[model samples]
Target: MSEAKSPQSTVDVNTMTAIGAPRYGDGSVLRTEVVVRPNPRPDEILVRVRAASVCQGDAHLLTGMPYLLRLGFGLRRPKDPIIGHDLAGEVVAVGCEVTGFRPGDAVFGSVNSGAFAEYACVSAQRLAIAPTGLPLEEAAALPDSGMTALQGLRDVGQLTAGQSVLVNGASGGVGTAAIQLAKALGAEVTAVCSTRHIETMRSLGADHVIDYTTDDFTASDRRYDVLLDLIGNRSLRHCRRVLAPKGSFVSSAGAPGGDWAGPIVWMGKIVLANLFVGQQIGILLMRPRRTDLEFLAGLTAAGKLRPLIEKRYPLAQAGAAVQHVLDGHAQGKTLLVV
Candidate 1:
């Protein structure tokens, strides 16, 4: 860890291109514009973003779906219009208080927001060295989805080696990571996806692949110790049928429910259902940590985990990228090559 300071980097460039939404609506609201590049605070680092990924959360911010998000995000419009969070980039400068990194380090991490630009200021605590063997584009795909999978399975779900774990909606960003992480945790992994993604799930080390297009996984007699639900398409009773008596059900995402509350309503339903059920049902709100980022990096370096990238877009096409994710049929992560 080096504590070195570079010159005030923001002096050279005042503006940079970014994808921003002036007001909330849909991906159509995202516009590529020349915005002021941010300066790193004393505890932050200025990164020249190489790649950033589109997440479902970005869609929520764009559309203001599940209206509850508007509470922290703005009552009428987003407080911060620039979108995106996960990124992999080169450290261009570091604030005086950021001791662990310096200029030119290859880093990957999550930020509060504003990663849809070529340059982003991120807290020192949120980033880690990019894995040596992976490309920056792939590393950019790791933070949010990877961390969500890890916390949902190992932390909230309390999954352990030899336990039977099933990942529903196993072909999207978080779903792909969940399948691999469950295997890395030594659980017997079953992945549920549409017919097209069945082979992809199997290649990711799933012990079984259920085609949701052809059969209802919940209708089967098989039981699992943990059910990681990335899609909330199934009812509580339907999902419960697949879980063991003492199993855990962890949800990281679900359908937007309606125009106002979105997944918050689904999360509330899950919480209320837990009180009377034998299985532990909970929703995963991922808290990103430097150590967890390092852990995922180690897994990637060791070939125990690999981020699956489904598509790439340029900064100009951010709207399409976001729309692709919101459509919810992507096979894996989607990246914006900044």
Candidate 2:
């Protein structure tokens, strides 16, 4: 791997735009001249993005889809100039207070912003060691998608053994991971996806599969103890119909703008709704934490959970990767092999 650009190739955020093409707006794609902050804050560490993966949220922000997320990411453009957050790489430098990681340690994690460049500054708290057994390209898949699954199902859904959980959009990014995680947590996982993807979802351990093309999952009399909705296609009423009286509904954001008025909007609505009933409905933010990554590493290291990567691209093709995620309909996560 190339050494982190010495303080030499490095320039202020205004001086550079790497080879990646940054999405400019509704009909624009720029040369991606990016701003690279020269130094880290007291709690930050600079990571060289060895590999990065695209998430649906990244694509939404890139394309200004759903329209409303513009409020949170940016009204007209993205807040982060470079749009890749699920990253894995070696740390080149650490801030004055960073202790968990040091120069040369291999790490993987997500950042609130910035991951597409050769180097990026991340809060020390957001990173965790990458899995020792996995290659950097593969480990890059964990922090964002894996942790989202772990948090959304285990933490947000409060998934437990014997509960029947339905994962909508089960063939997409977070959906793929949730199926594995729900099964690990002992839930009888039900994966809801288009007909083309039922076999794939079933291969991931979904106890039952619902093909959205042929039938409406909400119309079925079969109810669930937990509903993990990755796509917002189903209405609250639709979810409520199949929700057992004491069951809860956990929403994993997809598309954007409309499904969320920013993440806080959905979160607030769920919190408020939870007050009136035994069922729980709320948005989930799956942060990449050390413990969560480590737990997932244990699972990967053992072979219980597999990252079903759809395709891998070289770094120069990063835009195509983003576009692929935007187009949707992949069997699993799409990665950039940097």
Candidate 3:
């Protein structure tokens, strides 16, 4: 981690550049604008964001879809207009109540909002020290996707050593992280992805790789103890077909069904089906926490896990970066460098 830098002696603290959306819409709604720099609350810290990563959640929020989300996110407009989550940077100022961090400490964690900017105010509780020797961009990429993978495999799937696990959509940010994490947990990993990503999946420690273009993984006789579905394209019945009896099926992805409905209808269906089956069928809603961030940081520091960054965009091009993630072709993470 970097020592705290003295912003008072080195830089101006008035205004900063940030990406903000005036109203919920497509990526074009996002624009780079100058805004007043924020101050840390009594329990918060002011961070000069060096880097941040774009996630599917950010894309979903940009549209304010499912209308249900708007209940808490803002019915007419986002409650907080600035949107972003994963961030890695240096703390330039700490609130009086803050103790674990000081100015200049490099940290990585999720922000509730306002991360696509030169500076952001994050609660001390949401952050952890960045892994030693890890670049800010890579560290920034780890929090959201990495935590989702860890929680899904360990907490939801109950994956155990020597268990057979299959990761669907094995090329995206969460899928890549899941592959490595499942291996780290001693599970034999089978990754399902497109033809081009087979080698990439294998390189990430997958014991087997299936190209979805040439083969339907659900049609195979292979049975897995846990199926981590990052692509919700398949039906629940199809997914259950590949699961071993009494095994777990965790779904983390779904297609947008309706403006107000979103994936809730599908998730409800899974819940209903669970009543008749012996297998575990459910959806994963990833919650970000500081302890999980620290645990993942430890793994990264020990070289047990690493984030795969597919592209980097400067602050000025943040809109394009978000579009790339929305397009659903990025092999790993897309980062924004400040």
- Model 2 per-residue lDDT tens digits across residues 283-334: 7876667788789878877777878898997655666677777666877998
lDDT of all predictions: 0.88, 0.75, 0.89
Candidate 2 residue pairs that clash: 13-35, 13-36, 17-33, 17-34, 69-257
For candidate 3, report its TM-score. 0.94
Model 2's TM-score against the true structure: 0.85
lDDT tens digits, residue span 160-199, model 1: 9999999998999899999989999999999999989989
Ranking by lDDT: 3, 1, 2
TM-score of each: 0.94, 0.85, 0.94
